[model samples]
Target: MRKNPVATKAPAEQVVKDIRRAMRKLHSSEEKIRIVLSGLRGEDSIAELCRKEGIAQSLYYSWSKDFLEAGKKRLAGDTARQASTGEV
Candidate 1:
């Protein structure tokens, strides 16, 4: 049997709360991607990060892809609505 690491088991509620706090400050999809990666770095586990963030591995991967592509494709797409309506 594999032994579970003492530090590896994370409470679901705690993870959700932590992710929520990170989410509140993130306004753009780009920012969300950054926060998710930061969370992954802190935990260093995709499964663990997915569990805490209340999202599936697919979503995380999808978002990560968007984030990396954000540098080139994000600004114009990100501000379109705001610029059009003058919301930003």
Candidate 2:
């Protein structure tokens, strides 16, 4: 009797890790800003927004906090000065 090579499989942990990595979503900065702004609009509850966007409430809050802090810094003109030369 010949063994079937097709029946071979990777370890369960490795398979799970691969599946999780594949399922992970990479959102662009624009998309992140949009989501944060939407949450701030108050048109919907934060929990509901998170649910609709498939993110955790905590993640939404973290993004919101970062967005607000950035705006605050910008309004306060606390931005760092850019180097005049592009050369390293």
Candidate 3:
């Protein structure tokens, strides 16, 4: 009996890595803000939300922290302004 040549399997590590890579989603700033806000709403547990979003809890926390910090700085009028150059 002849064996099938196309029945080979990839390495476990490589398969896992590929899945992780494929699972990564690129979100825009608006989408990120929406996600963070949803987490803050507390309608569901953080773990559940993370699972639904396919993201880690740590990532959600990081985004929340950055969003709050930016708001704080903006409220404090700490925004950066570009310097105007005068022609000589």
Which predicted model would earn the best TM-score? Answer: 2
Q: Candidate 2, which segments miss by more than 4 Å at Cα?
A: 1-10, 81-88
Clashing pairs in 1: none
Q: Candidate 3 has which clashing residue pairs, if any?
A: none
Sort the predicted structures by lDDT, highest score first.
3, 2, 1
lDDT of 1 at 28: 72
Cα-based TM-score, every candidate:
0.45, 0.73, 0.66
Error of 3 at 8 (Å): 15
* Model 2: how far residue 54 lies from native, Å: 1.0
The residue ranges of model 3 lying beyond 4 angstroms of the native Cα positions read 1-19, 81-88
lDDT of each candidate versus the true structure: 0.68, 0.86, 0.88
lDDT of 1 by residue, 2-88 (tens): 777655656766799898888863347655666567765775688877776667788777777776676556655754333545654
Cα lDDT tens digits for candidate 3, 1-88: 7666455444666789999899889989998998899999999998998999888899999999999999999999999867768632
Clashes of 3: 0
Score candidate 2 by TM-score against the native: 0.73
Instruction: Supply candidate 2's per-residue lDDT for 58.
Output: 89
| Candidates 2 and 3, the one with greater TM-score | 2
